[model samples]
Target: MAANEKIKEKISHLPHKPGIYKFFDENGIIYVGKAVDIRKRVSSYFNRSAQHNKKTLKLISQIQDIEFTIVDTEADAFLLENNLIKQYQPKYNILLKDGKTYPYICIVNERFPRIISTRNKINDGSRYFGPYASVTTMNVVLDLIRTLYPIRTCTYNLSPENVDAGKFKVCLEYHIGNCKGPCENLIDETTYNQNITQIRSILSGNLSVAKNYFKERMAAAAEEYQFEVAHQYKQKLDLLDDFQAKSTVVSNTLSNIDVFTITSNDKCSFINYLKVMNGSIILTQSLEVQKKLDETDEELLATVIVQLRHEFESTSREVITNIELQLPLDNVTVTYPQIGDKRKLLNLSLKNAMYLRKEREGRQEKNKDLSEQREIRVLETLKKDLRLTELPRQIECFDNSNFQGDNPVASMVCFKNGKPSKKDYRHFNIKTVVGPNDFESMYEIVTRRYKRLLEEKQPLPQLVIIDGGKGQLSFAVKALKDLDLWGKIAIVGIAKRLEEIFYPGDTLPLYIDKKSESLKLIQRLRNEAHRFAITFHRSKRDAGTLKTELTEVKGIGLSTAESLLAKFRSVKKLRELSQDELAQEIGQRKASILYNYFHNVA
Candidate 1:
């Protein structure tokens, strides 16, 4: 490396002003910092009096350029620093780069203001509240508002043409007392304004006011001798109290700090920021571009703190979530309090952040569990029943449904870990069978399914389950053998009575696993397929039945039956026609013939 001369020149002209600083490498990746005096902060590396860590020394050596932004005050510097860190998540900084945007509840300032979720907060004639952790939480709060208040939640775009239009008609919500029906102008401005005021009061950490309002309503109802109405009010008041108790934690300095967490399988990061003013979270956003490849949880936490302290101007003694780290706090103090109310608040914020992360993760795991559950739960039971060495990782279930053998359809619902794998779901329409021939339908469906699987060069399942007993199981095995996949995939049949499971060629079923969740899982999959196929078959059969009925009419031969169906829509409508009218509309002779055929026949 070149001598330390180049680093000195960049630090020399640094101004002694309160602002944020950025250090850039040759590749233009930045490491940002904020200080009260830029000159002193930037010159700290050159100070013979100060000692820096090995990582800091390494970072100083890589700096190719230095840049700074001047701000009005330390607070301004602090806020700006956080904004820049979030924008340019440089190396040597703690980055919480979950691409999740904050959700705000936007109550528009309009004639009929609408409550909506937005990621952006602008002065566009609306009141915005919250950088709520998730849209789910915002929605929950919104649902509460809708439940308690009768304020209109409709979009306020009523035009002159629609002034009297029925589009503003009162919905069932008005009758059920969920809304004041502002769309229909049922409630006046003063009452609507009062409701909005109540919403604001409830949101601003004043839960007691809402509770008091409910209590007053309860008292009024009790005085009127309406016990049922009084009970409802009391219940609502109790719920409000519960909500307040859960969220109302007192913090040190009365500052609100939100901790954000982002975790992948092997990596976890926490970002902590304070919201000093009303509903604005400090540094609530971040971007992580160049993250650690093999970073331990502790290292990640340390990196976050060093970078966060460097980038954020506010050094208020606010403890970040989970991760403990040393920070510089001469002008302002940074802390992670371990005791009293501050600790409670810190822990609550951390828990909420972790819970938000988990809820997001749980949704993805749900999809995977659908298939994997089968292997763990279903196959475990199967192994115990069959005394197998290993559990079945791949399971294939086949079902057939039809209406009198018309438009017959078969479905295959696959499970990898005792859970449904929608990606592996396959559907087959019965082409060979006619008039309720389930065995033939099964054979065709199984043969066709396996043929496609082979053509696509896909692996056969470890276990195959047919929705019927020995006959259906044998049919599946035959298909497998024909396709040379028989010995590869295990075959079994799930019998209908008590829903017992049986292997191919077995006369008896193993229904003794009655109380097993795995058995219930298999039964559910098989039943789902049966239900799906039957629905399709019934739809096709019904259409055929109606057409068959229409075809019997003399004037309504195949084309006329099709036309009448195309025109009148249903057989029930055809039943409503008078003989004379039918004769006049169609040909006189043909109509008379049709009228006699339909009305007089049966």
Candidate 2:
């Protein structure tokens, strides 16, 4: 839990106020969080806590710098956190599952406006409302608006001058009574504007204006003894009533509130949100938050609350949840209801979250089963192709590497169930082999690997692969024979020139199909072994070169040479230092000997 001194210094100076904090590594920001007290929240990560998961520990290990922006209130912190996450998309933050935007009802700004549903929100002067979670609901709203008010549905540019010059004609919409023919000036500007105003009220969740208008019109028609006109008004009023009834899923008393509930497993959390306005549930959405730090349900719920509210432009002052939260939301009431309509709303949201969680778990389990079956099938194919008594479930490949007869090394890579078993991979330093003898190096490494396994009474591999032709395979077989494991393990050698496979006693090569799964698996093992051996050889060669250069100085032992190289990193850099500078690192006596040796001075 102890962070480096640099991180500790930053943590000590964090201000005790509301803010958004970002954790950055050498690459970029890795995590972002909101906190009522920045100092306490950031310090919690470095404290000894059993609750920290492996992901959080890794994030803490990579943090190079901490940045924070002070805000006026916790609500401001929440908003800033949401904005920063959307901007940076940090690796350790919960992201919305889908990137699709919800639908909004846009009232286009023009001489005669048209009401339409869109997923994009432009920054023009037009008014947009209802980012409805369901497009069907949005379409229902649009249809009702069209039925109640005969506004224009066409894309005609109905400017004052265009209408006066008779640039447009009445379309079929006007003849069918769906439009007021605003393009042909059949409806006056003031009258068309009155309909737009009432439509705006309906979109804003205030149906009282439209309902009252229809009631007044119906009364006027009835007073004149015109039953047909009055019946039309009655039908319009019933439409409004029916829409309200469907939207108001809970009590009519709940207005301008948000209800949230969360269900989580060890790896992810599902959050469901219900947005209520004017005593009606206008929006309901469920989101999947991929867990990065094994965050508690309360912490995840808080994040979702801020994100969903900002995305949907919710202005609710009250929030109901299934679990209590300790967040400091400015001018907002957090309630956990026990027994009421609000409790029922919370239960409904929780059910949605649970359903999403179950669906995700089932999908993951199915994927896992499919992966296991595929691995088994590949292993079975490999077993039949090689004609082995038992399945080659555990296979090991050996490779030798050297640089022009210098610093020879070998590597052994293991594969289990047709996949690389990195934990069992071993590197050898070519013990008992002189110069660049590939055959002896392979034999020595093969003997040393299994002799130790035999000594430890560990299980042996079912198959062994050598990355060379008959010469290398013969030596490996001899080593196995000497250890009484010659016929026990199925061994083969693959040559690089023609990709030929050779048996222990067989002279001619056994060439499997080029596209066969068995051949591909063998190629993968050989490539991995070669790569591992080359990497180990390069590192050893580099270290030896650095050591030999410094150790050439008279009276300089391996320990001093290693110490110097560790401090200066390279002999080339060591040569650039003056005797005085060298003396500061080693004593003046050894420093003089090393300096004169490098400078060729007496």
Candidate 3:
């Protein structure tokens, strides 16, 4: 556990500021927690005298290590913690985490760059814009860009060298006049590049140059009595205007503004984000975030803003919302526009948020019904195969993760009606066995799990799966028998080598049908447990790399080092701070000690 001298040294330096903290074992992130005072919150775990419930004790027992990130305020802490929990999905949290990949407009990184809509963003020196909330809006914009510019839309390498060698040919796009014959070098590279420059500027919300350039050309053609050329420009200008009209709800004064509004129900929260470029709503979409920790409206909204912008690849610095909150970010402004176009955009965002909320709820209800039917089928199949009295709607599988007796850990994954019961999944530190003894670890964890359940009078799973061959299964059965729960729960041991199922006291193993849903469910549960355990193990190994960096600073005793770690969390951050800043937290004397250590000016 982190109560060891090294980890305690790390804990003492935890920042007193609000932040998110994670507990890890060899397997992975076991628990993630948010605290207003990270130092105090972390210190509580190691404080021996503190009263702990069974669950807290279970969590604390396995924490071989810890890590944390400091945020500016409590609100930031809440938001960051929620995001981390969703990302890492530590075993202890019950999260309503949901995510979807949105689409982006990529200007391909190539000679004669091709513009297209893609969900994948790879940085190969290509310019990428927008995870457009609406595919319709993105397509519409793409259409306008195509219509306005005779840029190549085809997937051709229009390199000058290739064109000179006559290695490529123009296709239907060139025949239809939708693209200049850049592939044939009929249009010079410099001339085609000029069109690309204007397209780039227009996409970035600066359309004045493009609009003026087209208008000036149109006027020049008409004055020269070239009516066809003038008419063509007029048509392109009109098409551009039509595309802008779809997005433009308000006047052009409010440009490059990101409008955000939040709406919520009991189950989930929705955030609508609208990016106004050149006073047009270039991007409009509402995102849904599942609320797990009962975070406030302000906190949700703030958190959603950070997530959506990053996910959607939005860069608009001027953010407008229906309500105001401290953004606590640099070079970004958060405002509540009460009137005029800004307010109108805000209302539009709110409307989208509300509509999306209702839409999502309807879809979820429909899915719940379908899921219920599917689960019933799977559970019924499991019940018959296991010969259980009740439906095996709840199942649990256990697995241990260890590599050469380093950071040994165990995990249990739960399934409810054949679906992952994520909130019920658990990870355990092997308390009784020091080395890689999977059998003893299994016995200890099984006993602990059932005993704790009995104490709390909680509902036990109908099925308990031991992820091992015969020997490990026997150990688990003994533990269950000791707890007087052997027959109450229908337990089975799954042998990984042959996928054979063994019942207690049965020498002959049950070979389930390879195609059976029951077998698949068991495999999934076992795999999930193994995955959970291995992930924790890797995180523990990674944290070990940073352990030795802090031991060298003089005047920093073990307690002082731990205190510094509890406050700073990172040696790099401590080294980066000025003596005055360091003095404010630690005393002036220690601050000088740290400053001199990093600088070593003598």
- Winning candidate number (TM-score): 2
TM-score of each: 0.45, 0.84, 0.54
Candidate lDDT scores, in order, read: 0.67, 0.89, 0.81
Where model 2 places Cα greater than 4 Å from the true spot, the runs are: 1-3, 9-21, 33-44, 47-51, 67-80, 97-102, 119-124, 134-137, 154-156, 172-177, 207-246, 542-602
lDDT of 1: 0.67
lDDT of 2 by residue, 1-602 (tens): 23588899999999999999999999999899988899999999989556687888898889999999999988788888988988899989887744778899999998778998889899998999978998988889999999888878888788899999999999898999998888888888888888889999999888989999999999999999998999999999999999998887678787788999998888888889998778787888987888877888988898888778878888888999988896566678899999988888888889988999999899999999998888888888888887888888899999999999999999999999888999999999977978989999989999999999999998999999999999999999999999999899999999998889898899899888999888999999999999999999998898889899878877888999899877777777888999998998888999999899888897
- Evaluated against the true structure, the overall lDDT of model 2 is 0.89
Alpha-carbon runs more than 4 Å astray in model 3: 1-15, 24-27, 30-36, 40-87, 91-101, 362-602
- lDDT by residue (279-388, candidate 3, tens digit) is 87777766677765455678678766766666666667889988778665556799888887778778888998989988988898999999899889888888888778
Question: Model 1 — TM-score against the truth?
Answer: 0.45
Worst 10 residues of 3 by lDDT: 541-550
**Per-prediction backbone clash count:** 16, 0, 21
- TM-score for candidate 2, please give it: 0.84
